[model samples]
Target: MWKEAAAGASPDLEFRAPVDAAALAEAERRLGRSLPGQLTALLKETNGVADGYGTDIVWSLDRVVEHNLQFWSPDTFPGLYMPFDPLLFFGDNGGGDQFAFVLTPERPDIFVWDHENDSRLWAARELKDYLHRSLLGEGDWYR
Candidate 1:
């Protein structure tokens, strides 16, 4: 289903090995929150997804853990932008902008975090919508 979602948009998308349940559990433990169910299912099918140009459309489990940890840490940005505690960043646009899921209220919608101005805006309805848009469209499709 995960592959089909992207393949429906582009056949050239790349994929990495699937992550095991244990690893996902560890990641959740580290983040102090569970990953969205759709995302977890996708990770179980493939650890990550990338475009033909090697851009990470969906980051691997390890990168997911590390990136979110950094974003959640106060020392990482420290007044440069809004607190990242409410977001769980997953991938990037290869131009410093990133994609994430809102965790505070636990919503399924996907949003783009503009790097320059630090604005958070709705991008897609859910993971599948995000995949189709991000895979079929160019770098700034969300905008």
Candidate 2:
């Protein structure tokens, strides 16, 4: 389902091998939280999604775990930005902006975190919608 959705958006997307259950479990363990169902299913289908120019539209399991851990850490970010505890980052624009799902309310909607302005705004309804928009459109499609 994920691969087809991505391909439909753009055949140029590069897909990595599927992540195993053990890797998923380890990722969850390291993050101290369960992964979202759509993200988990997508990772099980393919570890990551890359664009033609090598941007990580959806990061691999290991990258996902590492990035989230860093974001969740209070010391990792400067006091200039808002707390990242409520966001589960999974992807980024080629620029500094990142995409995430809200975990505090456990919603499926996707949001974009603008690294420059520190704004968290709605990007898509869910993972599939995010994929279609981000993959098919150029630049910050969410805006």
Candidate 3:
């Protein structure tokens, strides 16, 4: 089980899931982009929720898109389903500047969706580091 301390809330959050190679490949095809190698490798090893101490964050690929089926991808990892404001992390660029964090079931790093910029940024450290320092802090609005 992978767990991390929530900055907004002191309590820890857990994200879990199982790795599905077929689904991952399909997600890559749907998104028309290859996932980071490290992320792919991690998914191959651990096929369960990969965040928090005991919380179930990441859902199985098959069970991931219940809330937003339109945006759901069988190949993509399911998010822990936390209710954070996406507008806080994503900018207003007519949906082009939006992004989402896809937590894998195997590792702590996150897969980001830079919709407006059309790119993906993989974290070198644990996802918590990026979330705590970059996304959640009060710095220049545009970095």
Estimate the TM-score of every prediction. Answer: 0.98, 0.98, 0.33
**Best model number under lDDT:** 2
Q: List the residue pairs that clash in candidate 2.
A: none
The Cα RMSD in angstroms, rounded to one decimal, for candidate 3 relative to the true structure is 10.9
Residues 17-105, candidate 3: write the lDDT tens digits. Answer: 53678877885665444554533443454432322333223334433323234444444534633323221121121223332344334
* Tens-place lDDT digits, model 2, residues 1-143: 99999999999989999999999999999999999999999999999999999999999999999999988888887787899989999999989999999999999999999999999999999999999999888777899
lDDT for residue 27 in candidate 1, whole number 0-100? 97
Residue-pair clashes per prediction, in order, are: 0, 0, 19
- State the lDDT of candidate 1 residue by residue for 1-143, as single tens digits: 99899889989988878999999999999999999998999999999999989999999999999999988998999889999899999988899999999998999999999999999999999999999999888758988
- Using lDDT as the measure, name the better of candidate 2 and candidate 3: 2
